[model samples]
Target: MTHRRKTLLRAIAPVAALTLALTACGSDDGDDSGDKKNDKSSSESSDTSGSDDGDDATDEPTEEAPANTGDLPLGQAASEEKEIKRGDGTLKAKITADKVDTGENADLTAAGFSADKVKGKYPVYAYFTYEITEQTGEISPGTDLNSTTAVLDAEGKPGSRFIAIGGQPLKGGCPEKDRELEWKKGTKATLCTTFLMDEGKEPTKLAYGMVNPLLWAVK
Candidate 1:
């Protein structure tokens, strides 16, 4: 086990002991005030400790940076904050990115996903969305055109290990081969996806999607 795990376990025993001891002391006869005070103190302590435990469990570890990633993968300039569902066992994904790179001509900070939702064991899913500039000539985003809402499963690189059930189809790849966007560009959409983590009840992940404005609608 990691040192951090060991420390958490060690702390648990002491917390339990302290709680039991105080609880027992409070149960003893008529020193009513003392008992009440002990109970109050115990409850407060537990609450604080509970918060710490929750923080520890929810804290995600750092992972490797994206491969072939652009500091910014959007064009013009924009910033958005949204939430989505993802992960192997049900989790909300908070996504945020800049529309333009700090100082790179063809680089834009595109909105994307960093997830761990997969079919098999210990699988991870992460991807980015580009609202492309919609190039005209040899100026392909490969040349030039902001690359507005580019595509998804670009060549199934990592593979469609995770399928998006509720969200509309991403633009670039097969442009609405699945469903059309709500409008054209600059629209918002919500995606209610149920991630299948284990043989459990609730879905593993849930997230809102803002892509292919042409397909995704406010509904």
Candidate 2:
């Protein structure tokens, strides 16, 4: 009876030792899986934080306003004559005389212009004498004294129609010529135009072109 009991106890002890070893192995695997999960969560959190910072760094900046550099004021007469150069620096112009005159003057009549052609009641006229020079190229004449050349009031508004006197000869004044006069390189000519203004309106400047630099104020 004692021998039988000893054999059974030995067999039961081996089985119990095997069960304990299996349980220990399972516990270690569970701990490893938990550690892997924690590491993955930490990495994902860091990636999300980095992505947010990158978005902020790539944000667009605000725009600024343009600076106001030196520019001539409107209606202020220049102390001396001002020269305007063309974009290609080939043509140059200077305002020789700019003044207000009556449309009934002898120069207008002698040039074959009647008072009926003048639009305003008082028949005030704004005359501009421009001396243009072709520095490099041949510029077509009579093109510079067209409708674009206008007399502007103090508010920068253009005056009425240009006085046309079909290239007629005048007494003691420049002839009113309608034909195109071509200027070769290094040559110059005097061009003139007369604009009709409203009654009691005074011309403050001459707008030779669309730009402000081409505007010449009266003295």
Candidate 3:
């Protein structure tokens, strides 16, 4: 009876030990799988973060106004079409192209101011208009607009008959002592000028056009 009891006990002990080993092995396998899943999640998170960073770059706009209008040596030297409005003042002028002769000697004359430069030169005047204030002066006999009233030259120089006008080559301010009337709108005057061009710096002749303003000024 005693030997049979010992044999039963030994068999049960061995079986229990085997069961414990198997349970431990299963738990280890589950832990390894969990680690692999964690690695994949980490990799996915890194990829998403990089994508978000890339989107942040290149997320912002570029045009500038013409610098110093009518306050420079050559009208800011703009090759593009531009208008010199009164500073901080709202004065509109309807310019007329009474003459536009573009050849080897292209001459464009209109408005009250006349831009006299060698034809066919770089930085030449393509378009121009002047607001001759309602004043009194002699422009060119037929031209009622005052020549020295307050003229903006092709080089962006603002000239005034006023004595206190500043001495800036590009911009001229009205001197208090000699300021004449501004070239205003509604001046009933005839628009007359000739376009001339020539070889080099000398004006050769009037080659192409001489016209008159259909309707130059609007109040």
Clashes of each: 34, 2, 19
What are the lDDT figures for the candidates, one per model? Answer: 0.18, 0.32, 0.18
lDDT of 3 by residue, 62-106 (tens): 001111212222112222221212222322333332222222322
- Model 1: weakest 10-residue lDDT segment is 3-12
Best by TM-score: 2
RMSD of each: 24.2, 42.9, 41.1
- How do the residues 142-191 of candidate 2 rate in per-residue lDDT, one tens digit apiece? 33332234455555445443322132332333234433454344434444
**Candidate number that wins on lDDT, 1 or 3:** 3
Candidate 1: count of backbone clashes, pairs at least 3 residues apart or interchain: 34
- Return the candidate ranking by lDDT, descending: 2, 3, 1
- Per-residue alpha-carbon lDDT of model 1 for 97-177, expressed as tens digits? 211111110110110111222212111212223342221211101110111111121111111111222222221211111
Off by over 4 Å in 1: 1-178, 201-219
TM-score of 2: 0.41
Ranked by TM-score, the better of candidates 1 and 3 is 3
Which scores greater on TM-score, model 2 or model 3?
A: 2
